[model samples]
Target: MRGTHPSRRLGAGLLTAGLISLGLLPVPAQAAADTNLALGRAATAGGANGGYPASNVTDGSQQSYWEGPLGSFPQWVQVDLGTQVDL
Candidate 1:
């Protein structure tokens, strides 16, 4: 039977030690719950094509999108989260 290489044995030992240390480490407490606070919320855009409205930005549908007019400079979109959130 062939013996395992010294480097391979050392690598495997380090990997095992790392995994065991990670398991013994204390885990952080869960932060605030995760939720999409932007769903169905109010949204406004600087400008849009005739048919496309600013509300489409938060309609939760990729098929629909707000179309800004051509040659419009400094266009932007904004969403209201209804409440201030801490970053």
Candidate 2:
């Protein structure tokens, strides 16, 4: 009540209740933080096709994709996470 708008508080509580009832809320998630661990990290690849550097994969954009040189078999790309993390 103090420093709080009644309607706003009610609206928030109602929304939370609705989401929970609809099963849209994942309460008490037992997992690591949902995040892109490799975004903007240092990356290295066997090779690239023109502008598609190894960093493209870790740039966090689906539209932009990395490509290996043509006719290259078993191409590989590596991203450094700066530290070990749970997969």
lDDT scores for all predictions?
0.79, 0.88
Residue by residue across 1-87, what tens digits does model 1's lDDT show?
999999999998898778767775443333333555667999888888888888888787879988887789888889899889875
Q: Candidate 1: lDDT over CA atoms?
A: 0.79
Q: What local lDDT does model 2 show for residue 53? A: 95
| lDDT tens digits, residue span 1-87, model 2 | 568889999999999989987879876543435678889999999999999999899988889989999999899999889988875
TM-score for every candidate vs. truth? 0.54, 0.58
> How many backbone clashes are present in model 2?
0
Instruction: Report the backbone clash tally of model 1.
Output: 0
